[model samples]
Target: MTETRKTVWGVLSTANIAVNQVIPALQKSERLVVGAIASRDEDRATAVARRLGIARAYGDYDALLDDPEIDIVYNPLPNHLHVPWTLRALEAGKHVLCEKPLALSAAEATTLIETSKRTGKNVREAFMIRDHPQWLRARELVQGGALGEVRAIHVSFCYDNRDPANVRNQLDIGGGALFDIGCYAVAVGRFIFACEPERVVAEVDRDPDFGTDRLTSAIMVFPGGRRLVFTCATQLVRSQDVQIIGTTGRVSIAVPFNQSPDREARLLMDDGTVLKGGDPAVETFGPVDQYLLQAEAFSELCVSGSVDPYGLQDAVRNMSVIDALWSSEETRGWADVRQD
Candidate 1:
């Protein structure tokens, strides 16, 4: 028997995520290998490449894209740079797996959808949560009638970050609580409900100095009256939780967005029989790295041309809800999500 050839992946930058999480995960996957890394500074790129055991380091992004051995590009660039760089990677004949909140808005994301079709290369937003077993079980319980008709989901995610130079504090470059952390709240709602929200309303609190949203809360109305209410903040105690409510039961995720890769993940399901659901059943999943799963899955997609159906199109849908949320803040009223 012969071993199958693993896909080669070029990382776009030495951004924190690429260095601290995604690069390590990609190196761990049997289906993928880190072929190269790039940065505006060649020395920085070379240092990261050497530290991560990558073979090549490019002084510029296009150099990595020009590498014929590179079959895929993992882009963890800033929010504003997602679309342009992803488009460049696609044109360079490499599949792309970009970071979450794939674009600043729905219309910007659609360009990737069109470019993917035109270039015949795949592009996927890196929503790694969808690949986690715990989240998978959560979706199964909801769809399998365990949750009885899931009615609503509530999410709260926040952290403390006041650095003036941090990308999350820059407004013109798409920095805010909504773009940085709130996107998970929006994406998970669509992931669980398996449909787009019809409309949304939101309230935002901007930092007086940074001019970026320090806190944001929103409500999304899905079909059949299902809804998602969420609040995300960047200047508060670090915390995250999710609860899925239904007619008969509910599921609570203590750490929904940033589950530690080394520890087991557990979810609580309650039938409302126990007082305050004190004795809810616990479903546990052994340790797993979702980023690794994401890399392997995309590698499979690249090798076989299997469509994820929920690739770039789903990204546009997620961005639509986000777009509506921003619009709601301005109008101080509900804004219909743009479906087209």
Candidate 2:
């Protein structure tokens, strides 16, 4: 007998992330089918559906969620909308894979977690960096004691988002350097250290015109006294790097964070040995394919009645750190993460 296909998926927005990544990924995944595409504008939704060859297009997000054929909902909406739509999808009995910074605040993320439990649905935050092979290998090295007692970590993810009208510069929509790029730094820090930070201290620079943060630098101290110094900027040139320093040696990965699953990445050790990895020729179909992998993982969990590595609970903890960092900036001191 032939095995049945795994899932029927929907796109929650016509955002670039979906247009470029998710749609193509769904087309590529053998286990999934693109059921529909949704946008606030009818024409845009129709156009995207045609371009992606999706069966249906809905002008309203709720319509897509209400569709019985859509088993998975890929939400790439603005940051502030993540929580609401995710909760709506869960309540509608659709598995949700939402983009990063899962929700604008920790409270919102907590609500998502609780709702998922009560509703018995799967909800995950799209942190593709963790899903890539290189990142997985790095984590294994750190966790396996190959690095021998990690001492400090330094990470940076900065890029120029010069579009004044772009949502990344909008505060009300939950746009800022911290929400956009700083999230990756925080994720890498947590993964390298294998735990949440015990304390967070940060400083943020607000754009005079946009009124949103243009830059943020934060220092997180982890349980084993490991320090992670990181920075993110929306007004600077593109750069991504991560370094893990230990007592015996150290490891560094160039372009350590991003959507590129197949880019050339290097691991440098203290002994002057450089282990090369990642494929420079492998082009990223964009964040969507990563989202598909994420979707597949979530579906496996749903099928086996297991929990994902990065579930709604993990999203809440990550957001708690984000909230604490912002609060630390306001208080001008280190702030402890408040868990629910």
What TM-score, computed on C-alpha atoms, does each candidate reach? 0.97, 0.91
Q: Pick by TM-score: which candidate is best?
A: 1
How much is 95 displaced in model 2, in angstroms?
0.9
Across residues 157-265, which tens digit of lDDT does each residue of candidate 1 receive? 9999999899999998889999999999999998899988999999999999999999999999999989999999999999999999999999998688889889999
Output the TM-score of candidate 2: 0.91
**lDDT tens digits by residue: candidate 2, 1-340:** 0126667888898999789876776687777788899999989999989977889999999999989888878889999999989989999988888898899888878887677888888888888777665677678878888778887889888888867789898889999899987888888877767788888999999889888888899999888788999989999899887888777667777566654534454565553343354322221223234555666666666666676778877888888899999899889999998755
- Each prediction's Cα lDDT score? 0.91, 0.80
Candidate 1 residue-wise lDDT at 140: 94
Q: Give the poorly placed runs of model 2, Cα more than 4 Å off.
A: 1-3, 259-265, 272-289
Say which candidate scores most in lDDT: 1
